[model samples]
Target: MDRHSYMSFYNIFDKNLLEKERTRSFVLLNIGDALKNHEIEVYYQPQVDARTGKLCGAEGLARWNSPKAGLMMPGKFIPVLEAANLTYKLDICIIRQIARDFRKCIEEGTPIVPVSFNFSRTDFETCNPYEELQKAVKEYNLEPKMFRVEITESTLMSDPAKIKEQMTLFRKAGYEVLMDDFGSAYSSLATLRDFDFDEIKIDMGFMRNFSDKSKKIIRPMIMLAQSLDVHTLTEGVETAEQLSFLQQAGCERIQGYYFSKPIPYSEFVQKLKTMDCCDDLKDCEK
Candidate 1:
C-alpha cells in the first residue's frame, strides 16, 4: 500500500480506538450509578452434589445489560471497575441481590440451596465488605448459612494479614469461606495453612485442557483439601468425562455446563423443582 494511504488508515483506526476507550471508561466509572439503578443483575449457576447428582448450591455472578454497550460479561467489566477502585459497589450489589433471592425463595417455600459470591481485594481495600454483608443479610432477613464467601488465591496476596483477620470475622458470624481459583495462581501452601478456609474451589481453567495430566493435578488437590478437612468443589465441568472424574475424585460439588449454565435464580428454582431435588436440598447445606 502507498505510505500516505497507510498513514491515513492508521490515524483513523487510532482515533476510533481512543474514542471507544474513553466511552468504556466513562461507563465503568459510573457503574456505581448502575448499581443503585438495578441495572446490574445476578445470574446463578447451580452446583450439583457429585455423589447424587442433585442440586446442592449455586454461585451468584454479575451481569450488566447496558443500553449502550449491550451485554457486559465479567471479563469485560470487572477489571474496569477494579481499575477505577469501584469494585466494592458491584460486590455489595451482588451480595444484597443474592440475599434478596434467598429471602424470596424461602418465603415462597421454594426448594432452596446456598448461594456463593466473591470478594475482590478492592472490597477490603476500599470498604468494609463484612459490614455491608451483614447489612444485606439483615435487610433481607436471610441466614448466613445460605451464603458462601469466595476469595481468589491472588486476592490473598493483597493483604494476607488483614484478610486472615476478616475471614475470622466471617467464620465467627457463621459464614463459610472458600479459597476460590485454588490452582489458578502462584498458590501459597502457607496461605492455606494460615487461613481457616472451609472449602477449596478448584478453578475451571484446569478443565479447559483436560487430560490425564489434569487428573493427576486435580486429584491431589482434592485429596489435600480432604486431608485438611475442608470441602472441595470444581467448577467448569462441561462434559460427562469431566463429571465422572470429578465425582470419582471426590469433588463434593460440581458446577458447570455439564448440568446447567448461569441463569436467573428463578429459572434455577424451576430447574430444582423439575429435578425433584426438594427432598435432597434439605440436606445439601450439611
Candidate 2:
C-alpha cells in the first residue's frame, strides 16, 4: 500500500487534499483507485448459533486499505465519504464485492452461510440501491439466501416512510432484512412497529455498560424478538460470561471479540473450515 506506486492518483485531487496536506481529503483522493484496485475490502466477522455454538452467518464490514495511510477503519473515513456525497459509491462497491466473495464460497463447495451487509440511509436516497443490488446478486448467479441486508435503527428514524418501503422491497425480494443497532437510538420501538425485520442486532452499547441493569434490558429485547418471531443476535460479546448469559437468555446468534475481530474473507473462509465454535474459542485478533 505505497502511494508512490500510484502517485498520479493524487493529481486528480486539489493539491490541498493530497497526503501530508492540511485537510482530510487525503482519504478522499484514495477512494476511486481503492475501489478499482481492490484496496477497499469487505472483512467478515463470524456469528455463531448460540445454542449449538457453531458458525451460522457473518457480517461483512468494510475496511479501506489506503495506499497513503496503511489501513483505515470505517469510522475514520465513512463520514468523509458521506460529507462528500460519495457514500453511496463506497456502499455499492462493498455489496458487489460481497456478491463475488459469496459466489466464490459457493463454487468451492463451502458450507453456504448468509453474510449481512449494512446500507447507509443515504443509499436509499442517492440511488436505486435495491435494483442495483439485485443485479449484482443476479450477475453472480447466486440465490437471495446468501445475501442479507442490515439497516441501522437510526437510519429508519431519519425517514420512516422511505425506510418502510425499502424494508418491504427487500423482504419481498426474498432477502432477510436485519435491524442493526437495535437499542442505540430511541426509535427502536417505532421502527419495530412499522417494519418487519428478520433479525434484531441488539446494539453493543448496551454491552459496553454491561451490568445487572443492562442485562435486564437485554433480556426483554431477546424475548420481544422471540414474540415477534424474529431472530436475535447480540454484538460486542467479548467474554465467556457474556456468551454464557446470551446463550441462556435464548439469543439465536452472537458476534464479538470473544470469537474474532473482523478478518479478510480469505482468513474467514479458513476459519470456517476449522472453527468448532465449541466454547473453547480463544480470542481471535487477525
Candidate 3:
C-alpha cells in the first residue's frame, strides 16, 4: 500500500479504538447528579506569608467521591467532562460549592481570606462567563476579592488579546488573578506582559531544587513580578530550607508542607483552633 493509504488506514483504526475506550461512558453517567448529591468535596490548601506565619489565602482543589468510583481527583475526570461538553456545568458546580464553603467559613468567625480556583481557556470563551461569576458572588453574598482565579500560561498565551480582555474584567470585578505554575512554559513572560496578574505562583520544579542554577531561574521571576508590583507565591515548599530560600528571594508567599499539607475542612478548622491556642500559650509565656 502507498503512504497515503497506509496513513488513512491508521487514522480509521485509531478512531475506532478511542471510541471503544470511551464506551464505558463515565461522562454520561449523571455527573451533575453526583455533584448535587454531595458526592463531590473541595479540599483547601493554605497559602502563608513567608515573613509572617499568618494565613494569607487558600487554594481550592476538587475531589469526587462516588458510590461507584469510591474516590477520584480532578485529573481523573475533569478532562473527560470537558471532552463531553459538560465543563460549564462542572465549573458552575465548583463555584457554587466554593461560595457556600466561603459563607460557612465566615459564619465560623474565621477571616475569609481569598481562595483560588483554576479556570481553563474554554471557560473564558463561554458566553457571559463573568455573569455566571457575578450571580454566584451575589447569591452567596461573597465579595469578589474573597476568591482568586488561577490561569495557566498555556491558555493565556494562545490568544493574548482575548485573554487580556477577559482578565481585565475579572480584575475590575475585584477578583485576584494569579498566573499559576510560572516558569513551566516558554510563554510565561509573554503571558505576563499581556495581562495584569495580582499574583504569580512559582512552578514546583524549581521549588524542588536549591542549586545555584535553580536560584538563578527563580530569583529573576520574583524580581520581574516585584517590579510590576505583583505578589509572588512559591509552591511545593516542603522544607525549611526551601522556605528560607523563597524568603531570601523576596517571594511574597510560600505554600506546602513546611507549613502544613492540604487537609479536610474539619481538620483545617481544628488546625486554626490549635494555632490560636498556641498563640495564647505564647502570650502567657511572654
Candidate 4:
C-alpha cells in the first residue's frame, strides 16, 4: 500500500475508536443520571428449600428502566458502569432499595425472608462496605439478618487480605456472607479455607452435564461445605430432574426458572402472600 493511503486508513480507524469512546462516555453519564432519578430498580428472584420447595429467601438483582431504551438488564448496563468506575454508586443504590423494600414489607405484615445482593470487587477496594451497609440498615431500622452479601469466588481472588477483612466485617455486622459462582473460579477450595463465608453457592454450569461423573465432583464439594458447616445452594436449576439430582446430592437450597424468574417488587410480594396462604391451607388439611 502507498504511504499516504496507509496514513488515511489509520486516521479513519482512530476517528472511529474516538467516536465509540465518546458514545460510551455519554451513555455512562446518562446512567449516572438514571441512578440519581431512581430509574434503576431492584428485582428479587426467589430461592427455595431443595427438600420442601418452600420459600427460603431471595436474591436482589439490579435493572435499569431507561426512558429512552426501555427496561435494561444488568448485563446491559453493569459493564458500562464498571468501566466508568460507577459500580460503587450502583451498589449503594441497590442496598438502599433493598432496605427500603424490606421496611415496606414489614409495615404491610408481609413475611420478610432474607435477601442477598452481589458486591463487585471494586466495592471492596474503593469503599468501606461495613460502614456503608450499617448506615443503610440503620436508616431503615432493619436487622442485619434481613440482608445477605454475595461475593463471587473470582472477586475474592482479587485481593485476598482485603476481601477477608471485608467478609469478617460483614459477619461482625450480623450479615451472612455467601461465596457466589463457586466452581467458576480456579481457587474455590482455597477461598473456602481462607475466608469465613456462611454459605457457598455452587455454580450452575455443572448442571449442564449433570451425569454421574459431574456428581462425583459436585457431591464432594457439597459434602465439603457440609463438613465445614457452611450451607450450600445451587443456582440455574431448570428442571425436575436437575432439582432431584441436586436434592439427592445434598444441595441445601436451589434457585432458578424451575420455581420462578426474577420478578418486580409488587409481584414478588404477591407471590409471597400466595405461598403463605397455601401453607396455611395445607396445615389446616393436616
Candidate 5:
C-alpha cells in the first residue's frame, strides 16, 4: 500500500476509536438511569459444603438487561459507573434486589440462607452505613442476619477509622461481615484485626494450587481460621480433585461449579426443591 493510503486508513481508525469511547460514556449514562428504573436482576451462585455436598449459601451477583446492550454483567458496566462516580447508586440497587429475593425465599419456606454481596471502599466511607443498611433491611422486611456483606481488604485498609465504625454498626445490626478475596491484597491482616469478620473466603489463586502447595499455605490458613473459630470457604473449586483437596485441608465450605453454577433465583429455588426430594428419598431407603 502507498504511504498516502496508509495514512488515510490510520486517521480513520483513530477517529473510530475516539467515537467508541464517546459511545461508552453515553451507554453508561443510560445504564445509570435504567438502574434507577429497576432494570437490574440478581443472579445467585450456590456455595456448597464440601463435606456433605449440601447447599450452604449463595452469592448475590448482579445482572442488567439494557435495551441497547440486550444483556450485561457487572464487569461490563460497573467500571464505567464507578468512573462516573455512581457506585453508591449501583450498590443500593443491588442491596434492594437482595432483600427482595430473601423475602421471596422466606415466603417459600426455603430457610433463608445468607447471601454475600460485594461492597466497595466507598460503601465504607459513608458516614452512616449502619443506618443505611438498617433502612434497606426494613424496607424489605429482612433481618440483618439474613444477608452477608463482603468487603475487600482494600476498602477497609483505605481509611481504617471509617471502616472500623462501619463494621461496628453492621455487627450491631446482627449482620455477618466477611472479608472477601482474602490474601489477594496486602491488607488482609489489618482488615481482620479492625473488623470481626464472620467468614473468610480463600482467594481463588491459592485454591488453584491446593494440591501441590497444601502443606505450605492452604492447609495452614484453614487450620489458622479453625483455631480462631471463624469459618472459611474456599472459592473456585471447579473440579473434584480441588474439592477433595479442600475437604482434606479442613475448609468447612466452598463455592464453585464442582457443585452447581450460579443461577437465576427461580432456578435456584427449583434446585433446592430437588435437593429436598433427594434427601427425603435417602431417608426412605434407610
Candidate 6:
C-alpha cells in the first residue's frame, strides 16, 4: 500500500473511533440529567398468588423517556449506567418514584401492596443501599415492609459476602429480599443454602421451554423452595398452559404477561381499583 493511502486509512479509522466514543460519552452524560428531569419512569408489573389468582404485588421496572431516543427499556440503558458508575443514582431515583406512588395509593384508598426493585451489584459495592432505602422510606412515611429488594443469582455470585451483608441489612430493616432469576447461574443451589431470602424467582427461561424435560427440572426446583419454607415465584408466564403447570407444581406466586404487562402508574392504580371492586362484589355475593 502507498504511504498516502495508509495515512488516509488510519485517519478514517481514528475519526470513526473518536465519533463512537463521543456518542457514548453523550449518552452517559444524559443519564443523570434524565433522572433529575423526570425522564426516567418506573413501571409496575403485577404479581399474583398462583393458587388464588389474586393480585399480590408488583415489581418496579425502570423505563427511560429519553427526549432523543424516545421510550427506552432497561436493557438499553442499564448496562451503560452500570458501566458509568451511576447505577446507584438510578436505583435511588426508582425508589423515590415508588415511594411517591405508594403514598398516592394510600391517600386514594387503594390497597397498598409491596413493590420489589432491583439493585445491581454496583449498588452494593458503591454505596450503603440499606441506609439510602431507610432514608427514603422514612421521608415518604412508608413502612419498610412495603418495599422488597431483588438481587439476581449472578449478582450474588459476584461477591457473596458483601451481598449477604446487604441482604442481612435489608432483613433487619424489615424488607423482604428475593433471589431473582434463580437457576440462571452456577451457584443457584448453593446460594439458596447460604442466603435467607424471603422468596425465590424462577428465571423466565424455564417457562419458555416448558417441555417435559424442563418440567423435570422446574418441578424439583419449586419443590425445593417449598421444602425450605421459602415462597416461589416464576416470571414470563404468557399462556394458560404455563400458568396451569406452575400452579400445579406448587409455585406460590407468578409475575408475567399472562397476568398483565408492566404498566404506568395511572393504569396500575386503575387495576388496583378494579380488583378491589371485584373482591368486594365477591364478598357481597357470598
lDDT of each: 0.84, 0.83, 0.77, 0.84, 0.74, 0.86
Best by TM-score: 1
Lowest-scoring 10 consecutive residues by lDDT in candidate 3? 277-286
lDDT of 2 by residue, 1-286 (tens): 8867764433365654554343356667778888889888999999988888788888999998876678889987887877777888999999899888877766675555778988887887788768878999889877776778999877777787887887788899988999999988877887788889999999998778889998999999999999999999999999999988898899999999899999998999898778664332221110
What local lDDT score does residue 259 receive in model 4, on the 0 to 100 scale? 90
Model 2 misplaced stretches (Cα beyond 4 Å): 1-23, 276-286
RMSD of each: 4.9, 10.2, 5.4, 4.8, 6.5, 4.9
Name the top lDDT candidate: 6
When sorted by lDDT, best at the front, the candidate numbers are 6, 4, 1, 2, 3, 5
Per-model clash counts, in order, read 0, 0, 0, 0, 0, 0
Residue clash pairs of candidate 3: none
lDDT of 1 by residue, 35-116 (tens): 8778899999988889987788889999987766777788778877887788898998899888777777777777787789
Model 5 vs. true fold: TM? 0.84
TM-score list, all predictions: 0.89, 0.87, 0.84, 0.88, 0.84, 0.89
Query: What is candidate 6's lDDT per residue for 40-86, written digit by digit as tens?
Result: 99999998888887777899999999888799889867887788778
lDDT tens digits by residue: candidate 5, 81-168? 6666566777777888887777776676665457788877765554355666788888877777767888778777778777777877
**Across residues 219-272, which tens digit of lDDT does each residue of candidate 4 receive?**
999999999999999998888988888899899999999999999999999877
Of 2 and 6, the candidate ranking higher by TM-score: 6
Report the Cα lDDT for residue 135, model 3.
Answer: 89
Tens digits of per-residue lDDT for model 3, 1-286 = 6766654333445876676456337646858678779887777888887877777677887788778767877777787776665667767777888888777866676545567888766676664556787889999877887778888887687577787787889899888889999999987887788678999999988867657899888999999999999999999889877888888989988888778877777776665555422221121111
The segments of candidate 5 whose C-alpha lies over 4 angstroms from its true place after superposition are 1-23, 208-211, 276-286
| Model 6 lDDT at residue 254 | 90
